[model samples]
Target chain A: MTTAADSTVQSAPVRPFAQALKDAQTRITTHMDARLGGDDALHAAMRYAVTGGKMLRGFLVLESARLHGVAEAATLEAALAIECIHAYSLVHDDLPCMDDDDLRRGQPTVHRKWDESMAVLAGDSLQTFAFELLADPRIGPHGLTLIRGLAQASGKDGMVSGQMLDIAAETATRPLDLEQITHLQNRKTGCLISWSATAGAVMAGADEAPLRRYADALGLAFQIADDILDVEGDAAKVGKAVRKDADAGKATFVSLLGLDAAKKRAKTLMEQACDALTPYGDAAETLKDTARFVISRDS
Target chain B: MTTAADSTVQSAPVRPFAQALKDAQTRITTHMDARLGGDDALHAAMRYAVTGGKMLRGFLVLESARLHGVAEAATLEAALAIECIHAYSLVHDDLPCMDDDDLRRGQPTVHRKWDESMAVLAGDSLQTFAFELLADPRIGPHGLTLIRGLAQASGKDGMVSGQMLDIAAETATRPLDLEQITHLQNRKTGCLISWSATAGAVMAGADEAPLRRYADALGLAFQIADDILDVEGDAAKVGKAVRKDADAGKATFVSLLGLDAAKKRAKTLMEQACDALTPYGDAAETLKDTARFVISRDS
Candidate 1:
């Protein structure tokens, strides 16, 4: 936060969303590698768990920063930090005592690849590392705001609450109604997505209402698409098991609304999300495509 | 953080270190209770995990802040946040995949009291809660510094690295040498302790050399005392298992230096810790007493 890196150019053309995502992936991978150090097993496991994410959250951060004319140098570590939080959540959620998944992102989960202890420690360390990255002086004074927001978004009031509700629902005699499921998804998946989508506005101290609206609708659509994929996605393309929601007898968008209705709902949400971006006009073309990709992509 | 609670100052003059610790315990417990919300199991588990313990780390933060003339109201939450981090560490450390202890602070561990999933989520939530507290605007501009320092002290480079080393030592063919054990102990216990003990100087933006030196020596002494407690302290009094370190054949101050030398080392370190506070003279009497308490306590 000592001095702003002196660049405010947003001159890069709107690349293909696919290519933008790839660029984000590359930048974040390199950023993360430079951030992590030590030769211990925990360090190795941390690197392992942080690898191979879709980088959608990271992309959202970068794209949002670009839209606001913020320098990428100032935002790249912020982008990397969010990915660390996301990756850590995945690591812990896949532990034996939690989701117990053996595979994630087409690779063995952290616990499976290293051990349960490694997963726990790696996830714990990664969580702290995210905060450390935010503390980097390069992120500017707004870094504290981001750190606080991230904590609130990911803690009991947000993602953890969603996970907790999911666990409670798994054992409850009654199935969750739509309202309840919505509340869960809003916290579990929507919280981080919303944070990422609005990060640029927070950094710029600009109005976030439009972006918030965009993210709210877009996050729901994203979850709905995840539900759709759960029902129809191929394992080879999805990179993990499919039909998990249905198999668990859990309530999801598709289970509450019929598959056809769920698909329709997602499309409507995508439209709503795009409409929220009218404030940005053509500059948001890639974001609009991102909303489409959320539903269309296999993984 | 919104408002300072009305003060009910302790009327008693500086009494025994026991009385001081009890005061810290009562304040932190009440403070934490107010901070937590919701009736869900996750919230309950979080409260449960943080309920007991000596509040030693919390006291260090509050005392350090007080030493710098920081108002009790301003530093209370910072103290609470450090305790939250300490509590989260204990909860995670007791997981089946980690230390796997069923008992902590003389009660069933979080996992034992609830379940493994609850423990995992509670610990995760608590970690986030710590960051949230640091972000509160009430913490002043230095909130960013606190957040950053806490991250460094607790992340892979600090506590996690120490834990990893300890675990690695457990499986190593040879016992860790004194230098190796010193490195592990410094990270696992010393880092956060040092942070807490120097928090006041940081908040005051004052020279930290003296407190830093005091903490460096005190932290090592604290660990040596813990090593002694593990060997000779009563399980009932200690509120956890005793002699487990010896049973595991873990290289500790006692194991490496023998009982007499370990005790002598702790005393010498305690004296060195007190000596570092010479600049503050009688004002640091409580801290000097704390150093003594660390070495002499049964737990």
Candidate 2:
């Protein structure tokens, strides 16, 4: 029952949230810069492609890691790995052969800044780097688990599968029903979001069943909220392409269920997501608020 | 001291090599089928792209694992992972945005067979799957090390770096010297090939330093042989798009130093590659033979 505005004021404004978020961004960029330092063009492409994104995935990872008491340096590797995978997906998704967008995060896409081939290699390098980061000895065997979890979320059965479905939906003669649209979005966008959160919890050493349920609910809720915002949000606020879904005639929550119904579904999902976090006491309170922010934010 | 025809005769005779190779092909396809169910087009891309190629990388893995006394089951996952990475690389390399090649191993490229988007996703899926395979619990903590070694070989500092240099080489006004060209080819092609052998050895619990040295020498020797073959080999023998290197005016051993000097350099490299196996006694003879076969073979 805790509303977003109330929690924003009542909780000492989550002092660490903004700084932690900044730290995560810095960590991600530092690793990215070091990894892609060979050529000036390559470095510029990697930089232009990665900067200015809303760190939603990073937030999920850091919040979840914090909830699980995973303060050790070992956990930083896992957190960075999650962000790298997310960034790689975005880079590829923006290619001319895929989404074909000229801008990402309010700047020229990698292909726009550099050539398409360089962009392709940049994304490829980034994706490979994610696994390499996790394989670092500092994280020990936990890095292995993180790598496996990420591969599952990002590979064929998860994100890639979702993308194929999205591509199919674009050309399908029959309009996708609510169930089908939800299924596609859940896999396409939600899988990694969920994985980011659950990876943190798992790093914290949370039990398997609770982690599964928590990730599943949080992932779905996050996507629904994102879909809702895509229809009503500002491009300046989101710092990326907005309403492009509608422009592309892509199946979305607003299209299938109408804005009112979509809003209702998002609220319901948010409650389910919060309920999944209830047993963790005050340690998980910020995660619950974060879920609300995911829905209610202008972006 | 060994020669190509002698090594060919020693390599399980033509009959057994055919049969065992066929069996290995069956095993690989069956494993892929089980992993990627029949429903997805991504699976189709994976199946069509991975199967039927010459299992040279697989041969490296199996021979090295056997040399290190690894059980078949223990090495299967690592071997599969190596092949997946190799397949993924070929798929991307053949993309219209990259090499723009139309044929691979005498079959239509994945992008030509399917659409470009599906080919990209298939390659991406296969790449991630390689890491997942290495991270399999069945492989244990050594799985982590194996994944790291493979990822490092395929990543920015390794294979991808080689690719960037390759792209730049096409436009460079100054012809690269022998060392630069050798470094490029070794990193571009040899890194992954070396990884194929090193991964098998790692999974088999070989000593790290020795395995690393062996993989390095074998990789360089393999590239040297490839450069020699590119100058003089026929397409019917190589089963690949031959002589494209010369057509592109790319920097290579043959281009930099002419055919005879290139051949002699290859011999020196082959000897170095073979000498790397001294630590493992007669057990590593097949792998050593493989190194010699790599440089000495016409194909």
Highest-scoring model, TM-score: 1
Fraction of the true interface contacts (Cα pairs closer than 8 Å across chains) found in each model:
0.87, 0.75
Q: Write the per-residue lDDT of candidate 2 for residues A1-299, one digit (tens) a residue.
A: 45444542113233444455667678766655664466556556656656777666766777777767775455666666776677778888888889998877677788887777887888887788789878888765467778888898899888989989988888999878889987997788778887787876666566645556666776776677777778887888776788888887878878888888877777677677777876786777667766666666665
Candidate 1 displacement at residue B248 in angstroms: 1.3
- TM-score of B-chain for each predicted structure, in order: 0.94, 0.88
DockQ score of candidate 2?
Answer: 0.74
lDDT of 2 by residue, B56-134 (tens): 6777777777767776765677777778888888888888888998888778899899888888889888899888888
The digit string of per-residue lDDT tens for model 1 on B1-299 reads: 10012101111123556687889889988888887778878888888888878888889887888889876765888888998899999999999999999889899999998999888889999999999988887787777888889999999999988898888999999999999989999999999999999888888777889999999999999999899889888999898989999998889999999998998888789889888999997778778778877887776
Compute the lDDT of residue A48 as modeled in candidate 1.
Answer: 85
Interface root-mean-square deviation (Å) of every model: 0.7, 1.0
Which runs in model 1 stand beyond 4 Å of their true positions?
A1-15, B1-14
Reference contacts reproduced by model 1:
0.87
Task: List DockQ for all candidates.
Answer: 0.74, 0.74
